[model samples]
Target: MTDRRPLVAGNWKMNGLSAAAAELDALAKALADRPAPACDVMIAPPFTLLAPFVAAASGTPIAIGGQDCSHLEPGAHTGDIAAVMLRDIGATSVIVGHSERRQDHHETDDLVRLKAEAAHEAGLVAIVCIGETEPERDRDQTLNVVTTQLAGSVPDAATADNTIIAYEPVWAIGTGRTPTAADVATVHGTIREVLVERFGEDIGNGLRILYGGSVKPANAGELMAVANVDGALVGGASLKAADFDGIIDAYR
Candidate 1:
């Protein structure tokens, strides 16, 4: 197995409010009793809760991040949050090119690349998400779509330390439908191959490639055991402490 460390990140997506602090607190408590976990953990709450969640996670291993950020530097982008702003508020990472953002905002691969570059400029890790929709998969274009997105969305400046590749098939996200273990392995392996070809063996192999889409505790163990599947970018289940803790137990 690769020596790359695993990372389990939660994408709260347009969800959560100040009241979600209790969930964070409970998560912290749940993790406190266990020995140091084998993987890194993070949650990307909505912009409104970033500061408070970061504060609440202090002295805990959990990290807080922003759901999305503007590609441009801080300036006249009304209703847009810049990556630097996220870092300014103690958010160590940012999610870019999520399927929701791609579909809802009509975000293109080139735009995603720019956003990831901005995250690097602000010294924040960019979780670059790439995947195919159900139709694309059904047509056998999964590899083409993901690799193209990987090439276009992930910036040239990306390295293992500053960038993460999350394969989140658009169809499976939040649908409670998951790819078969073999399917997950094949896609992740193809992704790893693409990274190695483009970024070189050392940097590519070192970068952690996470699987996202309908990931829950019941399947967390099975999914995480797949070759080249480093971790998960949980959606719905991450909203609760007990469910998230159950998923984290796979690494524990």
Candidate 2:
């Protein structure tokens, strides 16, 4: 991974409420007793909870991010959140092109790219997600699909400092099923190749590439150990402080 710092980010994903601040409190306490874990940590709570969660994690090492952001700047997009608004509330990063956004909302690659550009425009790191569906994986098109998404969804302005890539196979999300370590290595290796090729060695090799989908404490170590995998984008396991701490233990 060279000098790329690991980033373990929780994607709370349509989950959590103001009460969830307790979990951040607990997580903060857990980290307070130790030297910082050997990785970067962040959480993208629902929009409604961002401010509170940011407050809860204020003095801690954890960063607060948004789950999504609008491709357009502030305007009458109706229910859409601009990256600038998230930044205004102390969000340092934003997720773009998540599989759910791509599937449920039928977002095209161009739109995802625009959103990433928007994040950069607002001075936020864009965690861009890409992956193949179950059917595509079954047909052995994983590499091709990821390559295409990398080409289309990631913007030209992306740099190691402003972008992160997350690979989340749609079928495995929240299903308690995870790709084998070797499988993860293969996919991450492909992603790294595309990034290096497109952005050149310096920028690509410095960018962090994370794995998501079924990433619980039990499998976090194995997944993080995979080549080219700099960290994770955790889902269900991240909802609770204890479980999320356990996953963070992989770095500790």
Candidate 3:
């Protein structure tokens, strides 16, 4: 939270349609009169709306991203979009291996690794997600599961420039549940340790680690204040310009 630049990214998830474009424009216009906050902002809308959303966010501090990308650059992966394609469409980043994708699509860490590699290859920042389910948390195996996922999911080529880690408890995401500030600090600290050990001190400390799961403006400042909590990966609240803007203000 000190030297590390906070990044408040919105994961629009599967929501947002053409009309959602208005939210983007609204956000751009609303923030135009003010000085830029001491943080970064990004939004990952549904694939169908990336172009329009990016267009709407044009000239703003906001960066555009995709929810997911294919492991392969391009080929016969029907129904899948490649990282290159997303970049070609003006997306500067893409999320890979979110917990929902890991659960619904049975995406393995190896799969996530490949996808992250593809993102890096295409010059996109990969927000690689890692989290434990409710049962794992109940069993108090959160650190074990998180470390394992990080070890297996992050690409060897990953660096501060190309990768960001998000720690979202499965039980918390969209459930209005969240780990306490102390707990959040512990996990993020652990994740930071692993990152430094794997990627070296400079890159690891420089890499941003975001907290996700039911993040809202009301609780954002406290969460962002926690050690090692660089920012947030907002969910439902991100779909609304007002809510997302409020969350971004947490860094101020």
Candidate 4:
């Protein structure tokens, strides 16, 4: 087992505004006097709030990130923001290949791979997400599907410092239905095996693998305690200061 520090990252998704700044403020205050964990803490808000959030998190253990970014550095992609731009605005990380993008926008693994490369090229940490849907799970193809996504979405140059993997089962996200501990162990272990096979034991063992999907304060500690479950990619629970802070406390 590697000694990689755990990380609890909040995905604010499309929520938050200057008015919502209170949430982050509250979170900052809650984390202030508490002993920092052996893990890292990150929050990914929408593009519109990245700068303000980054500013608020300065001098704190909290790191701010972007939800997604365009693969191209700069272009006429109009609405699309590039990874370099996010970095320029003080974002320390970016989430790539999230299940929502894959399902809603029909994004393929190849596209996710390119975006991850863009994040790497821009010197930003990439949190690549991969998991199977409900049907895939029901059909007993969870491992196969997850492995394929892990293989295709993660780039070859991936390292512990530059990358993190979040397993967010499409079925579990926002549905309040989490897999059993044994189930989570099985998948995470398989993911570790794949990483070792592809990246060699040294780097693979050091990689951080997070479990996401309906993760809340109630279950955060239990999930974090599981072998290979280094952290979480929180969804709705991340939108509120109290809830997100609770999940962070679970790491302690």
Candidate 5:
């Protein structure tokens, strides 16, 4: 059994507004009386509502994270928030190398590594995402693609404290499709091997490997039960309090 604590993280994407207030309220209430999990719980909301959410989450066990951040710390970069700035705003972590950023903005693994380094430098945990498209999987190159991404995107200084690896199959992001249990185990095990080879057993074994791609309350329990899957990087299902709370309950 893995000693790493499970982490259930909700990615709100570009959605949420004042209407999100109600959702957060529901989340707070749902978890209020419930015992906190042995693992971590976090939510990534749009920058606009981060402060509000952070304030609301204060005194609770929930953590606030950013969906993305600029590689540069602070500068003339337009429409970009830096890792340091995120920490200053009370964000405990940031998601880097998401498939959306890769597809929409054409971000490369090198850029992701730099961003992760920035997050680590600024004292925030960086959730570095890696995944393969459907074509890659069809061609049986899923492992190859993910290995390259894990090597290129993650920084050399990655430690259990400052880094997390999120394996999000690009094909499954919002397609309502998920890989089979065997498939998830294969990929997560492979990732763990890669981490161990590069970072040594102690650091590698301590690092949390999170599974993403169409994760929901329905499948959370089985997925979390799998080997090496220490957490989840939830997408659509995380928007609602009930759904996310259900996902969290899977760890129990």
Candidate 6:
């Protein structure tokens, strides 16, 4: 088997409130029952819920993270939360360059790289997301686009400890659609090759690559078992404890 460890990261996106910590509490309890999961598990919730969730999952192995963090230097950025701020709030990881941020905030690959760098500076693992739009996929530009984004968005300093890659087809996120296992294998293999070329064999091969886009319990087994797919970056299914655990069980 590959040296990469499986990493299942739940991205809560812009959803959740204080009341949502119950799910985190439940997940923490479940994790307590199984002290050692075969893979690492993470939950990136909305910023508003991080504190409460962290408090709720105090002694458990359930890691909490942020959906996004400001890449800008520490300063008065109004609504922006700096990477260090995320660290201060007990976030062990953060997702950078998510498609929603890319499309909605007009974040370029350069900006995403800066954010990832910032996350590393603050001692947080950065889960960088890359994907092709429906049109781009249809145009057969998926590989080219993804490789370009991978080169630009992934910092030269990335290491297994500080960086994770998630491939989420734009049209598939929350749409209940997914690429075939062969398709996932092809893309993930391509990504690994690029990583090995850019970062060298050892470092590149050890970085975890996760599949995202409508990931649910029913489809997780096949997706997780793909040649280069180390785990999943779950969305809606992650919002519920039962659903997320089921997805995590794919590794089991």
Q: Which ten residues in a row have the lowest lDDT in candidate 2?
A: 28-37
lDDT of 3 by residue, 1-252 (tens): 257888999998989778888888878876786667788999999999988887877788999999999998688888999999999999999998899999999999999999999999999999999999999999999999999999999998888789999999999999998999999999999999998999998888988999999999899999998999988999999999999888887866
Candidate 2 C-alpha lDDT tens digits along 1-252: 568889999999999877888899888998888667899999999999998888878878999999999998888889999999999999999999999999999999999999999999999999999999999999999999999999999999889999999999999999998888999999999888888988999988988999999999998988888899999999999999899988999898
Error of 5 at 243 (Å): 0.5
**Model 1 CA deviation exceeding 4 Å by range:** none
Q: Alpha-carbon error at 220 in model 4, in Å?
A: 0.9
Give the RMSD in angstroms, all C-alphas superposed, for model 1: 0.8
Model 5 TM-score, 2 decimals: 0.98
Where is model 2 more than 4 Å wrong at Cα?
none
What lDDT tens digits, residue by residue, belong to model 5 across residues 1-252? 367888999999999986787888788888887876777899999999999999999988889999999999698999999999999999999999999999999999999999999999999999999999999999999999999999999999999999999999999999999999899999999999999999999999999999999998899999998999999999999999999999998866
Tell how far residue 169 is off in model 6, in angstroms: 0.8
lDDT of each: 0.93, 0.92, 0.91, 0.91, 0.94, 0.91
Q: Candidate 6 on 23-110: residue-level lDDT in tens?
A: 8878877776754668888898888888887777677777889999898878878999999989998989999999999999999999
Across residues 1-252, which tens digit of lDDT does each residue of candidate 4 receive?
757888999998878777888888888888886776667889999988888888989998899998998889798898999999999999989999999999998999999999999999999999999999999999999999999999999999999999999999999999999998889999999999999999999889988999999998998888888899999999999989889888888767
At residue 151, candidate 2 shows an lDDT of 94
Q: Which of candidates 4 and 5 is the stronger one according to lDDT?
A: 5
On a 0 to 1 TM-score scale, where does candidate 6 land against the true structure?
A: 0.97
Estimate candidate 5's alpha-carbon lDDT, on a 0 to 1 scale: 0.94
What TM-score goes with each of the models? 0.98, 0.98, 0.98, 0.98, 0.98, 0.97
Name the regions of candidate 5 deviating beyond 4 angstroms: none
